[model samples]
Target: MHERQDVRTILNRTTNTVASIRFHLILVAILAFPLISGCQNLKPLPDGLSLQGGEFPSSEVAFIADTSWIDENGQRQVEQALFDDLFRIIDKAQEVIVLDMFLYNDFQGPVPETTRPLAGELTNALIDKKKQQPDMLIVVITDPVNELYGGLQSPYFEQLEQAGIRVVVTDLRKLHDSNAVYSFFWRLLFKPFGNSAANTLPNPIGAGCVSIRSYLELLNFKANHRKVLIADHGSTYVGFVSSANPHDGSSAHRNAAIRFTGEAVADLLQSENAVLELSGHAPVEIDIPRDHVNATTSVQVVTEGKIEDVVLAEINRAAVGDKLDLMMFYLSDREVIAALKQAHERGAKLRLLLDPNKDAFGREKNGIPNRPVAHELTAAGIPIRWCSSMGEQCHSKMLLAQDDTGRNVIVTGSANFTRRNLDDYNLETDVVVRGHHSDSVFVAAHEYFEESWKNTDDRIYSLPYERYEDRSFWRRRLYRFMEWSGISTF
Candidate 1:
């Protein structure tokens, strides 16, 4: 009995030692993975995009939610002028039509809006274009999230495929996994087991249809969150970079886009084609006409890791008398926060129009990282405002900095200023536009922020920062930890 007791104690000690070593090893891996992945060089865009020109004519458009303003006596209203602008471009396409939208389904979830049938309108437009110009190259590139990451089949994709359009579903595995807490085990243990062959559960997006495998795949928090539309109309090409998603539920959201016509359009197209190539699709031919517009402004299409690099560079360059205007859905990225602080110290007039970080699909959000981050920024004397929104989010990811020397730079696109959105984890696209206020596009972008900020014309799009400020230390730490860990929806 004495011998047996000694043996049991020895075994218990050995088990504890093994457990400790395993825990330490996991901690080391978690710490090193992001650094290792981030250190590597970003993959290059497809060779097809080499024809992009640098100078182009560009215009800006916006959708302001003017419903909740006190000046409006009767009912609230949302000015959704973006879709019509999109339609104008689609109607004028003569040769090639390339669209890479992140959300293109009919899943509105809890607070469904009477959104225009944007999906059908876009589909019919594409189908009509294909019918009219059979030889015209119509390519539709989209993320796999439309099909809930392959748990369900998207009839929208099927329809486009049937219409003979080159539909390329981005292979998400090609991009970095932002939520790697479970991705390691998922890729090894579960992915091998495979997924359900048929749709088996209710769709989480409220489509009344989903599968177990869909939920399983969704646990991998990564996506191609870029929203761009490129139309090459023979001698001229126009591209739009914006936060607006054609998804019905997103129609009510306050969003913005820049309609640029020139060599930059081809560059945007090039970025999309690169995704197609890396996603294992065959190369499609893109015609490049020698096109350069007479304009003082220049535009560049930054994709993948370059988007983060360019945006940070713009922020870091801010100086005294320069104005930094930011309006975003989420802003939990430490790097950006640090940059903004540095810019503020340098005497740059800073204005932040932030989403309250509350409300999602009719569900109340505690304003996780944004509110806490806002509290930190607001304490530092940076004037902030909470976007007055109903069901839709103030989903625009935009930043503008103008120097006293009449130099202005605008950075806007689908990427939120969050770790997951900006850390080269999820695929993103942002256009960096440079010009003076004299440029119409530049003027429109400047006016959009100021109007929304000051509530011009009695349109209440935002409120003071004190309304949703949260200064709890624990919440701030929680947000920072989540962001650092890369476990975030933004």
Candidate 2:
């Protein structure tokens, strides 16, 4: 009996040892997953993306701005022209219409009162157009955030689809992982257990609850940040790229956009088609006729990483006695910061009008990124000013460089000069327009900058840098770490 009992005990101990070994092996594989998979190549950049251009008549491109400012009595005032023009462009379309907007939902953050129903208005506009021209091809492409990565249903998307509009939700997995450390495990584990459109967890950005999967997917920290609208208007194709969103929470923000028609529209369509192909949709079949050219300015389409390339090149091209003016929402890209300092050192007079990074959907934010970055730039003697936002962001992303030789270069569109936006993690679109300083487009862009900078009217558009200056060493360290690690939302 004693011998039998000893054998039984040995067998039990052997079973426990095998189980322990299996567990450790599984753990090791999980830990090594990111290092192995994260370095793989991302999807090939779409054709005709980085660089495409032609000399276009200055009349073919027009600059438009939407300004939101506060009066001396603290009344919030808005002069909006961007969206009004967009609606008119949509109304005028006769054949093909393609829109790729990042935020197209009515996700009202804390301050719902401050927001206009931009999403509803935009949705109605598209639906109305589709109803008017049933055979006209209309495609809407957007990010998954609107649906909370399948955790919540988007009424706006549903309404559009019901109107026979094709909506394409971008496949973010096809893009490079911005937050590599978290994305590996998310792809391996969380993604397989897909999500439901029934709310089960509290929503991160707004009122309703979302699924656990939505929160899990949000940690990946990436998006399809492009906001573009292309359409066939009468005899020509018109294209618009802007930083504005059809989102209620962002309706009051100050923004900038440009309307253009020329051979560049063909390149813009091709760049957008790359997004469609990656998202598993067939490209729109439309031929944009190359219109007659009376070359008065050079216009080029630059997307994704190409924006960083063009911006840096333009900055490095600055010489003594040149002027550089930048207006941005976020300015935390390390390379851009370095380039700005170098330009300043080369005697290029630099003026930065930046958001204070203080208000977001009515919530007070500890000024990060912009504040620390502002500190760094100001310490180096570069001039900086804070947009006097009345609970609305100065959300324009534009860079205007004027050379002493009377040549001017204007870079503007959806990119915010941040790592995620410029490093190809998020899709971006910007047009570089080069012309003599006297060109109408250049004149309009300059007037927009000067009026806002100098407060030419009774409205208060921007304030002195000292109004929201931050010199906290710890915050600076924190911003540096976050920007390097790709963990924070810019």
Best by lDDT: 2
Cα lDDT of model 1 by residue, 1-73, tens digit: 9999999999999999999999998897777655544422144333432222344544432322212232455
* lDDT, residue 233, model 1: 50
Instruction: Give the clashing pairs for model 2.
Output: none
Query: What tens-digit string does per-residue lDDT give for candidate 2 at 1-490?
Result: 9999999999999999999999998987677775644553355654544544554553578899998778878888988898899999999998999999998888876767455789999999999999999998999999999988888888989999999999999888777777877787787778889888666888888778988889999998988888899999788899898889999889999899888888888878988898898888999978887666887786788888889998999899998999999999999999999999999999999999999999998888888889999999999999999988877898999999999889999999999898888887888889888889998888999998987787746788889999999989999999998898888988
> Residue 414 in candidate 1 has what lDDT?
81
Per-residue error (Å), model 2, residue 179: 0.5
The estimated TM-scores of all candidates read 0.87, 0.94
Clashes of each: 2, 0
lDDT of 1: 0.75
